[model samples]
Target: MKIIKFGGSSLTDAISYHRVKDILLREKEDKVLVLSAMQGITKKLQKAIRTALKDEDEVECIIKEITKKHQIVATQAIRDTEILSDILERIEKKMKRLERLLYGINYTEEVTAKSRDMILSFGERLSVHIMEGIFRAEGIKSRAMEADEIGIITDGEFGNATADLKHTRKNLKKTIGQELDRGVIPVVTGFFGQSKDGYTTLFGFGGSDYTAGIIAYSLDSNVVEVWKDVDGFMSADPKLVSQAHFIDRLSYAEAAELAYFGAKILHPRIVQPLEPKGIPIVIKNAYNPDRTGTVIEKEGYQREDVIKSVAYTRDIGVIKIEGVGVGCKPGVLSFMASTVSEHGINIKSVITAQTSINFIVDMEDLEECYKLLRKKHSSAVEEVVKMEDEALIGIVGEGMSVTRGLAARVFSAIAEEHVNVDMISYGASKVAFYLIVKGKYIERAVKAIHKEFFKV
Candidate 1:
């Protein structure tokens, strides 16, 4: 069975919904439909939450807007006027109750994590209801499902909770199995879940993909297709590099590396389920579904290619350690690695000189990384300098290590464009090379590499 997810833009309105239905209907086999909240429902929900917390208007306006949008699609899709009207009323009432709870949260002088989770869950709640009605109206065998009903229990963390897979899989398997057997397409909610204690929980922003992957993997589905606005993970962020091309495929590790370093196209946990089960995910375009979007697999593509994608992250921390006694000490490097690791910060890159070693990490943990290492050996080391704002633009490919003079070509490309590279790193696998430079020069660096690799 295939688990198909329609992202926000794909199911934003009546027109998009109709197009999505056509796409699903065209498929011949049994499948499940996972949906994200409509394009702006989540944002409106956020605004409403704030208002409700402030004892302002109960956010009835935003709820009404959502109601109206869903109703318009229902009017076009649902042939049974009476049934559609009843369903619409049920949805509207639910929204009103959601608004009341938000106000009550304000009334109580508190918006507890548990309460906030339930409030935010309304986005997916409303979406699944509307889609279920649409499917039934069109003579499709489909049912709406609340997230909690399928056993996706998460931690009590309000904003960003991790999935409890064992429970999730057991519960979801029964529901999906029943639905598929009945030839019914179950439209499951994204972005929200419940706890072992019955409290509502969420899977964080962009966690919907995580939701879809979890479901797909647990149910042993053949594939998970993520339909998004972009065609796929591109050579670089299209907004940053206009000429960037879509990457056709990637290994799971490579995809995770990109996501870790500010790549927005894939969900961070999308691969977690696949990693253990060896499931493959296809990142396809909603706008142009047939395009060769990126396919992620457990195995690296055996076919050789010169380059894959040029990706970068501006949220980077660069620290230079310079001291007379720090040179060639047996324990000096050990101390550096151990201290940083203890802080739960991964060293993105580490470059060593005769008397210094410079390290780069994700910017958020810079202070913690610095403080831990500094307290232990700052004075003992000699001179310690930290560059807080820097970026790492990574040139990735399996062929780079084998490509003769690949390092020179990369540096030459950056030099010809007058871009400065402050540090460089290579791994034992020799699959990727990362260049650290001034954060402001990231775009310039990416453009230069893009031309060198692809434009050449």
Candidate 2:
């Protein structure tokens, strides 16, 4: 069995949907297809939710546009007139439900975490509905299923939740397994799942990939194919370095480190479930399926290159805490960690000295992170500093773990460019080395390292 996932761009319109159908039909193995929402739908829903929180009626216009967009895709893609009509009816019903939710939020003038997740989930829900209709119209027996319906239960962390692996695995085998056995292709929604209490919970940004991971693990599928618009994972962002090349293979750890450090091709969480099982993940181009995309598995490809890719993220901020007693205090670091966790702010990386500490976190969480630290840890922190407009550049490869002088080579390349390093950390797995620099230097740093390591 195979579990396949298509990104938003792969199903943006009628043409894309038809292409996905063709790809699935050609697959010889029994497969489960997972889909993200059409491009721009999730953003529109998020905007509608924000407008409702402001006690405005703007959600109607957003919902109308969303419904119309889906109708256009469904009508154009599904050839059978009767099937098209049925799909439109179902689409309308879903829209009405969304409208009611929006109206309730506007009337209450509040947007709780659970409500927000439910609002965002419509993207995947609506997309799969259209796709399933298209599949059925083409005489491919298929059923649309939501992630929650497949036994994907999570904890109550509304915005980003963790799956109860043992329970989820057992239930999915029963639910999805039954459908596959009956010769039906199950088209499942990608992102949000229900909590144990049945509240909709997200897996945070790029949650759709997480959805694919959980399903792949539960079924013990042969491979998880992630269909995207790109050719495959590259040695660097092509836009940054025109010389950047595609990498054909990577170990699970290398892929995860690159994703966490800012590779856009796959979400970091995708490897969470599949890694332990040693299942291979193929990142392929839906548009160019004949090309061999990147493959990530347990055993990495043996290559002469020690550095596989240079990844970078600009959405980063640094928090610096320092005092004579800062590092000496037993719980100083632990207190800072607890405070950030309490606020749901994730610290991406950290750098420490005898008298000071620097933390890297998502730029979106900067204000909350700074505020919480100041509010709670004022006594231990003599000085607090926030650095904005910085980027973390990472070089990832399993070969680096056994190779020496890799760090010196990385530092030399950056130094040659005169870019200042703000903070740095090597992954405990030795698969990656990430260093912070001014945001303006990202393109330069990435190109410099890619050219130095890969081209050599």
Candidate 3:
């Protein structure tokens, strides 16, 4: 059996839903479907949450708009009017529940983590309901199931909860088995899971992929196919480097590195559960189903390609702590790390010299990191330098670690383009090489490096 996952883009509207139904109907293999919230639904939910927190009256309007859009999709996609009515009725009940939740938040004047999670879950709930109706109307045996119904229990981390797999596997096998035995396609909602205490929790932003991976591992399925907007993984962002092309295959490690650095094709954590089980992941285009997409496997493509892809991220900020004895001060680095950890800010990359330590972080966390440093460690640090508008460029491949002069060639390529790298790091796993550069020079740097290795 195979586990198939559809992203938000694949279920954006009635047209996209029709395309997805056709895609699934064409496949003959016994498969289970995983689905994300429809495109724009999650964002709309979030907007309503924000408005509710401020006690704004506009929250009701947003909620109505969201319900109207979903109602339209169901009406247009499902040909049977009775099925559409049933879906709309169910959606109305769910929307009322959401309104009540938002009203509670407005009355309390606070949006707690638990409340926020509950609000976000409506996206998947409504999406699965509509899709299940569409599938049944199209003469396919299908049923909608929540993540909790399949026993995807997670920790109480609210926004980015981690799954308890041992418990999850035990419960999932039984429930999913029962569905399969009944000859019904179980359509599971992605992203949110129930905690042990019954509170709603999400895996993260693009967590639906992670959800699919977990389900795949639990079921011990042969493969997990992720349907998205694009064909597959690309050598570079085509918007940044027009010459970038699709890569046919990648190792689990290479794919993780690319996603972590800025490849938007897959979420970084999606490969964690699949890697240990040696499960292969295939990325395909939902619109153009016939196109061959990228595949990620345990035994990666046995090719001599030293560099599989180049990925880059802009809006990185650098913090430099420099003092006469800062590097030698044993507790300085430890203190910095602990303080940052306390604030839940992740340091993307760190570079150290004889007298200074540089912490690279996302721009969203830059201000808080700086504020914390100034408040706690002003005395230990002599000078704190802030560098904004920086970008991180990463080159990923399994061969880079074993290959010699790859670093030299990469630097040569960037230097030829007159790009100055602020700091560099070779990932400990040897799957990727990352460098920090000015944001303004990121496009030129990526294009130059792509041309150097790919010669495109």
**Winning model by TM-score:** 2
lDDT (Cα, tens digit) per residue for candidate 2, span 1-456: 889999887888899998999999989899999999999888899889988878565877878899999999999999999988988999999999999999989889888888999999998999998998999998989999998877899987988898888889999999999999999999999888888898889888787888889999999999999999998888898888888888998988888888898888898888888878888999999989999999999887545768888998899999889888787778899989888988778888778888888888999998888888877884778988788989998888877778888888888988899988877786466677888899998887888788788872
Question: lDDT by residue for model 1 over 121-215, one digit each (tens)?
Answer: 88788778778877888888888888888788787566677778888889887877888889998999988778788887888767788888888
Cα lDDT tens digits for candidate 3, 313-351: 886899898887787778898888789977768787778
How high is each candidate's TM-score?
0.80, 0.97, 0.95
- When sorted by TM-score, best at the front, the candidate numbers are 2, 3, 1
Error of 1 at 323 (Å): 11
In order, the Cα lDDT scores of the candidates are 0.77, 0.87, 0.87
Clashing pairs for model 2 are: none
* lDDT of prediction 3: 0.87
Better of 1 and 3 by lDDT: 3
Candidate with better lDDT, 1 vs 2: 2
Sequence-dependent TM-score of model 1: 0.80
Please give the TM-score that candidate 2 achieves against the real structure: 0.97
- Give residue 161's lDDT in candidate 2 (0 to 100): 90
**Candidate 1: minimum summed lDDT over ten consecutive residues — where?**
300-309
